[model samples]
Target: MAALIEMREIVKIYPNGVVANDGVNFSVDRGEIHALVGENGAGKSTLMKILYGMERPTGGEILLDGQPVHFHSSNDAIAAGVGMVHQNFMLVPSFTVAENIVLGQEPLRNGLLDQAEALRVTRELSQQYGLRVEPEAVVDSINVGMRQRVEILKTLYRGAQVLILDEPTAVLTPQETQELFAAVRKLVDQGKTVIFITHKLREVKEISNRVTVMRSGKVMGVVQTEDATRESLARMMVGRDVFLQVNKPPVTRGKKVLEVHNLSYVSETGRTMLHNVSFNVYGGEVLGIAGVEGNGQTELAETLSGLRPAATGTASVNGKAILNTNPRTVRLSGVAHIPEDRLTNGLALTASIDENLIVDRYFRPPFHRGLFIDYKVVEKQSADLIQEYGIRTPNGKLPVKSLSGGNMQKVIVAREFTSDPALLIAAQPTRGIDVGATEFVRDQLVKQRTDGKAVLLISADLSEVMSLSDRIIVMYEGEITGVFPDAASVSEEELGLYMLGIKRQTKEEMEAVL
Candidate 1:
């Protein structure tokens, strides 16, 4: 088969002198599911951007079906039947699924948008591709998996022949991932070409026919997926023997660190979000909270961290009541929180890295002298934290937004971990980070446990929850439905049942773990 897309010695360099792609020779066969796998900072995204016309290659030639071509912008690439779906969804929150699908290329009747035609096309595409999304549902009201399906549908609706999916499975649950893989297979069977970009080797092995590996702005190698092993891919990407399993000694539970009693809150719509949620976390142990997203997990984390006002009940750190208190008070009471969303809740993106590092402690000594800001001390401390956290940046003066997703997360972790609080609230700590960073973050949590710091670990990644958690609490409809002491012994299927409110445990069963 002739190649659907081809790049010959593509070279891309930014104005900052960072060479993202260098002499990258890549190609994808027509109607094939090709995967691009690499670690953070690799040229995978760069190469894809060049192909999709989001970026202009500094050098090299691109050919489509053996014909040379140049794409000056995304519109040009789209006109050539190429489309890209970014990691972060680009849909308007207020727009309906059907409206988002036909945003740029809406059907027209006379001079106005043809709503009937849009809905009909959306429904036809949904039925044909098995993407069962309600055309009328608002984007914000749907789950992440459904939103991703919408993204795919949007591209397909635009008559895209070559689809580029960037980190598609990063946010999906196991079952949702399976569905997406099935959909990818269907698309390929229907003679569509796909270029999947991801760092997960398992997904590559499962879905890709051929895989191209890139590392540090260079193409490492390309091989058939059937011939490549996870170890081989990891070594090619990182140039090391990566330890997939996190090594931690058995946990020794100590004194009580954090306790929540009958914590309940109400949503803006006057409905109870949490009801009598009670749990206790001990020093030297990680208590994992597992639930489907929007099941009051966000509310619970906010209430416990003093980011949201608890409607009823009390939460305490080291026997000190913190419910209804402000964030500063919570921090002073021996609580440190690693918020779920790093951009909105955890960081000031426009601020310098040094300022973000000292955000939690700017008022304390060393960072502050009476009423004056201590620039020297702050700079030194930020430098030390940056080194300790392995943050990759030229200097602390750079804005936090300049760093990659993993590096930004490192800054947040460095700030919170350096505080040495008695109770740590880590919510989705490894979300959106690469595999290496995920392992590092997990190791840090284990180290905190070893240091006798109680951790309330709320994560949507079931594997992470099962691996690091000393105990597990499953939430359903804003309430604790089941508690398990042996995290490794529990099955994902069983957790899914509790998460979906299909199963529940009696108060006696829950009390034993609590």
Candidate 2:
């Protein structure tokens, strides 16, 4: 039988002489969940963009059901039963789920929008596909996982026969990811084709029928899911034997570095967001904070880092007060924070790589000579860090926005990790990056612990927390639900129960977190 979709000799070259895709060929069988796996900027995104009509390929021919077709825009792709859900959702904040799902294709009743019909059609479509969601819920009020479901439902409602999901599980917790996998299987069983683009190998093995590995703008290999081992797949994606394990050093707990004594935070609307949260990180230890997204994890990190003020609590870094202080004061006191959303808070995208690397230390003595900025010193340091952290960049003089997602993250990792911080607050350090980059980030965090620096790692990725954390804590609904003294002793199932608010720790265990 002919394939459901095919791209013949795809080639895309930008105006800046960057060839994103070169002589690439791709296809997907009807009603199969096909995975497109690669490192960041390895041409997977570019290929998908070409397929979805988001970009006009410099040279390529797309065959749908064995007939040559051309798409001028996403509208053309949509009309041909193709749909894509981006990493950042595009739903309006004040709209309801049903309204957002059927926005452009709304039903009209005598020259008026039919609200009742929208809800009914959305419910029927969601129930038919087993992608359940609250149709009346406000889009902004829902969590990330739920919002993602709405996106999928919208695509299905629009009669999409082929679905493209970009890093679907990047922000989901363990349990939510399981649910998404179930939904993917359901969609495939119902005769829909799915193209999953991601950097996670485990998910590829778990969900895809066939895996296509791309690297450096070309297809590396293609194999059946049953025959592809994670190791073999990693080799294809990165052209190396990628090691995912972290060789942690021996236990050497030292003095407390960060102490949060009954920290409580409230929002501007006067809603108490964080409970009396209390935790302590000792030197030479990594305390992993595990929680579902929106479970007060963001608030906790912001409050501790001085981005958000605490309502009633005391936090000290190295026995010095940090509560209610600005981010500069906290950083000057020997703290380094890697915020969850890097593009917004981490770096200035338009600035040169060297300029961004020196943002935190520009006023320091070594880089500042007689109140004049030292460009040579800055470039030398940035080049050293680029080589040290394996940042794949042509030069430090290039703007940071020119690099791929993984390389951009490496820049942040190098800057913060090399600062010799007394306490490092790494929040989702490898959330959307590739497998190789994730491994490198994990190693750097482990190295910091070995060097006797306290680390507070907050991540929704359970496997990341399990592998790198010496101890683990589960947060749910603005409170710590469980604290595992030894991270290895607890199972993901048990931890997930706490994350879902199905289980709770005893009062004594909560007190022991300090």
Candidate 3:
């Protein structure tokens, strides 16, 4: 079959001389789900952005259905039946589902908005595409899965024949993911082509008909999905045999380094985000917090890390009070935190990489001598860490914001892992990084555990929590719904039950292990 869309010799060079895409060629079939996989900075996103008219190619030509075309803006791409759903959902919180769907192209009756027609159209599209949604439900009040369906419906309502879904399943639970896969298959069966960009190799294998691999701004190869193993695809993307599994050896649990009892948090808007949450992280073991995103995981991490004040309850590190204290106080009590939102909580974007490396310890002995930071010592430490952590950058003096996402994450890891803390609170440590970086970070977490340091791991990735934790706790709404004394003894499906509030253990059952 002839290609439905072809991008030939695409090249994107930023004004700062970064070659995002280098002589790349990509194509997709008319009704197939095609996956694009690559390491961070491999230019997969740039290529797609060019195709979607978000970026102008430095050099290339695009052909759609054997006809040459040029899209100067996203509006042009939309008019040509192309649409993109970003990793972050773009919806107005106050708008109803039907209103969000027909936002820019609302139906009109006598120079006024046609509310009835909008609901009718949304219902029609939702049923026709096999994506279920409530047209009248407010976007803010809906669940993540329902919000995603509304996004797809929005694109379809705009007459999109081709869809680009970026990291669609990043924040979805196992059950919600299956539903999305079913919906995607239905779309393809009804003649819609899809281009899926994701970091999860398993999803690539499961949802894609064909796969294209890229490395360092170039296409490595493209192959039929049935012919590719996860290992093979990972190797192609990173140019090495990446370990898809964590190599964690058995270790004896040690003294309790972190203790929390009835920890609770209420948002400024007066909504209860955490409720009576309790757990313990012992030295030489990892205690995993497993749940779907927005289910009190963020609040718990922030409260423990001193970023948020607790409404009720108490927490401590090594018997020193940490709850409701400031960040520096918690850090002084032997706590190191890798926050979930790296940009906001992890780094000072305007600071140089070397400066950021020492933000947590800038006022200490060697670096701080009589009120002046010793730049020479800081430079040496920064140089050593950059090499040790495999941070790719031209120099240590560049601002943290100038680096790619993966490198910025590496900087955070390098700083936190080397802090020598007694307890590590790692929240989504490897969320956006590639397989190689993920492997490194996971190994480091295990290393910390084996070295007799306590680790409190909170992640939305089920495989990550299951593989690394010695014990696991499941949260639903604002409470601990289930607890497994042995992480290895539980299944992903069983955990999903607690995550979706389908199952809950009595307070006595959870307290026994928690």
Candidate 4:
């Protein structure tokens, strides 16, 4: 059978002479779940962007249904029955799901937005695809899984026979992920072709019929899913055997490094985000905050890191009050934070890697000369850290924006991990990074714990939280729903229950452990 989509000899080179995609030949069969797996900067995204018309290939030939096609914009791709759902959702929060679904192509009645017709179309598509969503619910009030279904229905409403899902399950619970997988299977059974892009090898093995691996701007290998092992695919991605499991040695818990009591935060919009949250991280142990994204996890991390002010309560690091203080003061109080949004809070994108590496301590000690900054010391330190952290850059002189997502994360990890803090707050530290980089980051976090440093971990990846956390706390709607003293004893499903507020421990029960 002929493939539904095909790209031949595709090549894309940026103005900076970076070869994003080199001679790439890719094809997706009709009604098949084709997974595109690769490390960061492996060219998978570039290839998909070209297909979705977000980017133009420097050189390539694309064929759909055995006919040549060129897409100048996303509208062109949508017209050609191709649609993409980006990692970040593109829905308007204030609008209803139905309105968001039929946003651009609203049903017309007397030149007005036919609301009844929009809801009808949304319900029809939702039922047809088994992607259940409430037509009347505001987008802001819906869960992440439902919002994702709305996104998919939006594409299907536009006649997308070929769908591209980019990191679709990156923020979903295990149950939600399974629901999405079921919906995808239904779509495939109904003659829709899906191109799945993710760094998760387990999902690749479970969901895809075939997998294509890419590395260094080129296709490394393509193989049947049943015929490939996770280890094999990971090896192909990074050109070496990657350790999928973390080996953390047992450590003796010591002094309390961080203490939070009745911490509460209200957003700028006056919505309560964190409510009476309390936790303690002791030296030589990892305390993990596990929850669905936006359930006060970001607010909690930001408040504790001094990025945001707390409405009530207290947080102290090593017997010193840190809450509501400046980030620099928090750092000086022996707290190092790896912010969840690296591009926004972590790095100076336009600055050289050397400059970013020394931002926290550029004014202290050796780098701070009497009348001038010591570039020699800064350059040497940056070079050493670049090698030590395995950041894929030729030199430290290049702007941080020039590196890939994983490399940029490595820059943050290098700086934060080397700060010699008593407490480390790692928020989604390995998110959006490939398996190789994820393994590296996980190891570093574990190292901090084993070295007698208190580590506070917040991650949407449930498996990661279970594996790396010594103690786990589940949050729901800005409150602590449950606390597990032994992370290994609890299952992801159990954790998910607390995460969704389906199960809850009494406040006294949680306080006993806390």
Stretches of candidate 3 exceeding 4 Å from the true structure: none
Counted clashes in each candidate structure: 0, 0, 0, 0
The sequence of per-residue lDDT tens digits that candidate 2 reaches over residues 412-440 is 99989988899999999998788889889
| RMSD to true structure for each model, in Å | 2.6, 1.7, 1.1, 1.0
Sort by lDDT, top down from the best? 4, 3, 2, 1
lDDT of prediction 4: 0.94
Estimate the TM-score of every prediction.
0.91, 0.96, 0.98, 0.98
Q: Between candidates 1 and 2, which one is better according to TM-score?
A: 2
Q: Work out candidate 4's RMSD over C-alphas.
A: 1.0
**Predicted candidate 3: what Cα RMSD to the true structure?**
1.1
Relative to the unseen true structure, what is the C-alpha lDDT of residue 262 in candidate 1, on a scale of 0 to 100? Answer: 92
User: Which of candidates 1 and 4 is the stronger one according to lDDT?
Assistant: 4
Two-way TM-score contest, 1 vs 3, winner: 3
Task: Give model 2's TM-score versus the native structure.
Answer: 0.96
Winning model by lDDT: 4
The residue-by-residue lDDT of candidate 3 on 87-181, one tens digit each, is: 89999999999999999999999988799999999999999998999999999988888899999999999899999999999888898888999
Question: Residue-wise lDDT of candidate 4 within 1-514, one digit each (tens)?
Answer: 8889999999999998989999999999999999999998899999999999999999989999999999999999999999999889999999999999999999999999999999999999988999999999999998888888999999999999999999999889888899999999999999999999998889999999999999989999889999999999999999999999889899999999899999999999999999999889999999999999989999999999989999999999999999999999999999999999999999999999999999999998799999888999999999999999999888999999988899999999999999999999999999999888999999999999999999999999999999999999999999999999999899998898888888999988988989
